[model samples]
Target chain A: MQGVEQGVLDLDEDVNRYLDDSEVTVPETYEEPVTLRHLGTHTAGFESAIDPDVVADWDAIVPLETVLVDQMPPRVRPPGELVGYSNYGAALAGHIVAEAHDTTFEEYVQSEIFEPLNMTHSTFAQPVPDDSPGNIAAGHTRDGDGFQTVDTVYINMRPAGSMTATARDLAAFMRVHLGAGTVDNRRVLQTDTVRVMHDQHHVRHPAVTNWRYGFHEYGHPDAGVLGHSGATVHFSSHLVLVPASDVGIFVNYNSNSSEHPPPGTVIDEILAVCGLQSSSTEPTPTAQPGSRERAETVAGGYSLSSLPQSGPLQVIDVLEHVSVEPAAQNRLRTVTLAGNTRQWVETDPYVYHEVDGNDVLAFEVRDGEVERMYMASEPTGVYQPVPAHERQLVTGSILGVSLAGFGLSLAGWGRQCARQTWKQYRTETDSVTEGEHTE
Target chain B: MTDHSESIHSQQSGHPAEHIESDERTRSLTWLARVAGVTLSTVSLGFVLLLLVVIESGGELTLITRPFLMQVVLTLPYLIGFLTVGTTAGAVLAWWHRYWSRRVRIHHTLLAVLGLGFSWQLVRLGFITL
Candidate 1:
């Protein structure tokens, strides 16, 4: 974005033009080339893959271009088709910025974004650069009935998930974005550029959450809230900027566990303490006529597109299905395999709003069926329809029956062997009895 | 396997026809059932064992980081498919020839039906694009 502000790069220009050592070629299936704009909005047509090419060891980490070029994900969809979150796209954008300035990504961010905002302790360098101030937070995951500290997973895609910073630093960064490109009169970005970045760049629908240049709409489109969430293995953080109120809230968690409330609920608690607009204070949204019919039409299983579809991790898709079921009185309930359920009221033709919360669920319908759905809470990815064969009802039954077959077969063979042994023993006893009679 | 081609000594011993009929399972189907059953059982058991390992070790995110491990995991579906086909063929032969008792025949047919169902799921998931 700084590169764009300086006229060093164009948002609509071919991203490959800026690269010297590597390129993002348009796959043979796709005729449209990807651009920086596409990357920023996460609509670059790359297949959704979560693995960011983590290195086995610190010494194995290479330059960003080497990893990007070697592991460039195949463009499985046309550019601008739909948003599939891409770590590769984010890293590629970072590389383009570095290329524009003739410097490394970590150095460029340290000098430009971090230094200008006075976030002195923040650093993108992994193993945290020796001179970097502040102790890095340790990560933890669930163990048997307890939590255990684990080593942080390292990745070569430094620009995507390698940032290490304190909560204070994150607040300052959010304030800078919310301040419309200034902190105490120190202008890091022009006001117009901030507007362009914070405003909707790629909108799915007016009623649903849309993607700003880098941030995603949070809570609701009308709530004047935008956020970007980050997580790697056992660590998680969320930064929300309520631009209209000039209020920014940042939350960080050292451990990624379901025991903690989601970031939104935490933000809601803070807002309530602050006497700001919480979900309860908001007026109830009325449902449009014919809500029950629309709910029935869209009721089915959906798969998260962010999970890999062509890898061993494909099994994860089966476990991640979300089902929408019709509820009483013009409402719908979404249930996930993970057991998180949310109630939604149909407020528009295919748009639904959360019952108590402001999360928006907007569906794109074609031929009277849901094409895809975007929920404000899950900004990382959208949901696509899961086919009938792959649904749990079908797959689970097959798995159950096959396992039963294996068991019954073993039992049958065991029974046959037992009968033969009994026959042999009885025959031997009869022979022994006849010999005694002869004697 | 103890097939219906009862040994000459057992026949001479005057074992009834029903006794021979009860032991009519073929060596080929027996071997097929063993391979398919064991392979499927191993996978089901491995899933439980892997859950224990993950829970006991906290988590193993490194599995995703290494390409070698991912490549090995990617082959599992195909391995299951290959064994499924073998099981299906064995089941069909067992049913057509009444190769074993009614109980065993019914069990083999059920296994075939389940194998087809699972294979269809694999195809839907694109693990078996062909």
Candidate 2:
């Protein structure tokens, strides 16, 4: 086990080594040791290509580290760069695990993490077992007639979003964290380490004010919740624990709802099922105002004529358009939209800018509405509420990278075998010719 | 003594030529067989990779929203790679068989066509969002 841990760390180091030399710049070394906590929490400032989903075969195509090293460059944001979720951070953690054990990230997770956790149903490889107890839910989007399956994405970005575990097993793993890192008398993390894992790493997003090391922090600091939410094609899973209340809730839904349903829905439901509702008297507002407001501005739906008609038009699809987000004090922030999320400046009289040729369009509200709504020949568009199916596609792409990598590796091995055979035949033929000459 | 010398020289010379021609033919046939085998193997490997990709993708095609036509356009390179390699192997085998083997079977040609057909199917299935 110790050896495995070392291997995990080695992989992590390998990732860092690549990052250091790549265009993505980071400090040579941090004054403080960068722990798994930082990587899981998105404190590490690493950016990834938004289109990692288009890659069909990850392993046969490219290794995760190579892709990251070649494609990504570290552009550190202010310690808390909004609530910009970092897939790179999780990948770094996977790298750490690999480096520690002087082995591959996949092998380390299989031995140390998966084996001990008994997450037998889970794998980092794609095309998960067909005969597994439950069907691996297919991600679908309603086309004209019925739901059509979509291409899942591969994020050579491992560790962050490379895992594939069933809800039952993941819940059990969560229980260990709830138990402060000890499961079945086996300690996966020390109590203090677990606390560090749950400690708030960033407070950039008002929606999620506190982000613990690897999990999103919810509620007030004293009374809020702790845990991480995993989103992938048509599947959304959340595990929240109110350490104060000794309450833990694990929710997994197969539907593709883009609206991040109220954080406590599953937890609240579980509490009700258990006949315990501490805040039952407080009426639950079926309509959450914040999400509704954001939905109104961004979710009314708009079509981009310039976009290719094949897939859904994502925020990144409009890289040329200016995007603004509501920040503190009734002001909007100038943001660069990548996907559903944005990283913006939170200053007064907010300005939204998008790179147009060499110039930038700075958009602001002159009246009470978005000024110059339709700027260029590019049509003015609003956020179309993503159907449940589309949401699943987005989620699946995020989760599919690991599985894709595993599949690609098989193809690579096949090619290697063919080459080896050819080499052997050539060597044997040369030796035989030499013997004939001698005879 | 002269009769013995003449007999020995003629026998040795005739045997060497026959053996050289026979060995050349055998080598050619073996090369052809190897080429055919390798081509088939490559095609098989490609199909397997496709299955694995689909499976690993959780069998979802919706995630990749590019139109079927566009997908084909993008994946053209990979398909071409498979076809090029497979065809080269088949051609090599066919040449060997034609020169060295008694029976001029069109198996190599058929295998080449089959390999191309399989590649086409993969491209259609992978890129076309049907």
Candidate 3:
């Protein structure tokens, strides 16, 4: 984004112009060339790509070019068609940044962002640099019976999720954003660029979740929150900044065990402790009767656009589960991303509020049809309704055929047993009759 | 002496009649065995279809990240069950053809081919990239 501010790169320019076509050729699935703006905002409709080797082998590190080439997920949908959060897209942006600056992505970020902000502890290096201060937190994951310490899994797409940093370094990084791109006497990003990043640029749907340059919006622009969250196999972290209050909170947990509270809830608690209240007013929306019929349209299954739907990992897409149904008094009952059941009160014709009345859910309609849904608290707010055929065709066939085959085979076995028994009985009677005749 | 000779002749005639009747019964049993083989094969084919659809629709498309090891672990039960069903069905059909009827029918061959093919595909889907 600083590149955009300094005229070193254009946000709306075709990203392919910067990337080496041999190493990274994003298929032009749609006529609209993917722009840097789309990449940063996560509106580029690229499928999620996660190589299985990276998770299992900690030492199996690959170059970013190889990771990009091998795991170049297909552009399944048209560009800007929907907001699908993609790690691959973010990494692609990092690649573009490296290309524009004529240096490696790590070097660029180190010299530009980290050095400028004085975040001495943060480094994108896979093998944590030796000179870095403080011991890197040892990640832990649950074994069969107990937690086992593990090394940080090396991310092949390092730019997307591999950065390691301390809380102090993060505070320094946040201070720059809170200071409107200025920290002390240094300026990493111009105030105009920072304003562009915080301003709502692309919205998945109207009155739904608003997305800034790379940040997710949590409330109205006047009293909104902007931040990003990340998780690895054994580590979870979140960072949230409220520009209105000039305060940012960050939390990083070393274990992936469920015993730890979610990072979102922890941040919320921290904000509450800080006595930072949202200045936005809640709208009391009247309930529309079921006669509207449009309400029923939103009642179906939706899946995170960020989830993979191609290659081996596509199975996650099938398993990704969320459902919305009309509840009592026109309220909506939804299974949240956290797998918890939550009730929502209708806030508008298609907008709904969490029963707690904090999070928002808005359905996007195009041409009188519900096209997508945006939830304020979801990881990737834009959710496409799961096609009915995908749900019914495969599941229904498996269950129906299995049960039918079981009944048929059981009946055949019974018939065979009865016939064998009858034959044996008749043979015994015949032999007895023969003995009587001989006597 | 005449009455004894007549009794011997009647016994000889009765023996041939009994042998013919037994042959008929054996033939009927062979026919029944063949029918059972066909039924088992058809049922097994249905099971194979179900398994294939499941892998196509769910397994291949939705695995999360690089957790292939975990995927294999979770899918082991289904893989084992599939193999068990296919092998058992194939064995029953093969036994009927080789030991009981001593004749292999088209349906029996179909079942063997389908069972083996499905088992191969199932293992591939579970353990490796499909």
Evaluate every candidate with DockQ and list the scores.
0.28, 0.04, 0.07
Q: Give the CA lDDT, 0 to 100, for residue A10 in model 3.
A: 93
For candidate 1, what is the lDDT?
Answer: 0.75
Query: What stretches of model 3 exceed 4 Å from their correct place?
Result: A20-22, A50-59, A143-146, A219-222, A257-259, A277-283, A287-292, A336-339, A366-368, A379-381, A392-439, B1-130
Estimate the TM-score for candidate 1.
0.85
lDDT of each: 0.75, 0.48, 0.69
Which lDDT tens digits does candidate 2 get at residues A220-257?
33345676666554556667777656667777655343
Encode model 1's per-residue lDDT on B1-130: one tens digit a residue: 3665566657667567746664553565576665685565455335434544553443346356534544455456666677777777777777676666887667666666766776676665555656
Q: Report fnat, model 2.
A: 0.03
Query: What would the TM-score be for candidate 2 when compared with the true structure?
Result: 0.46
- Interface root mean square deviation per prediction: 3.3, 12.6, 7.2
Model 3, span A1-439: residue lDDT tens: 8888778789888888887643787887889999988887888878755432344355677767788888777787777677778888888888888888888889999999898888888899878877888898897766667777865567777687788988988998898889988888898888888898888778676666667888877543334788788777677888999888889998888876253776877887777677664533445655566523655778888877876655435445555557788877667888644668988777677887777546778887777777888887763647888876554234435435544544555566578799999999999999999999999
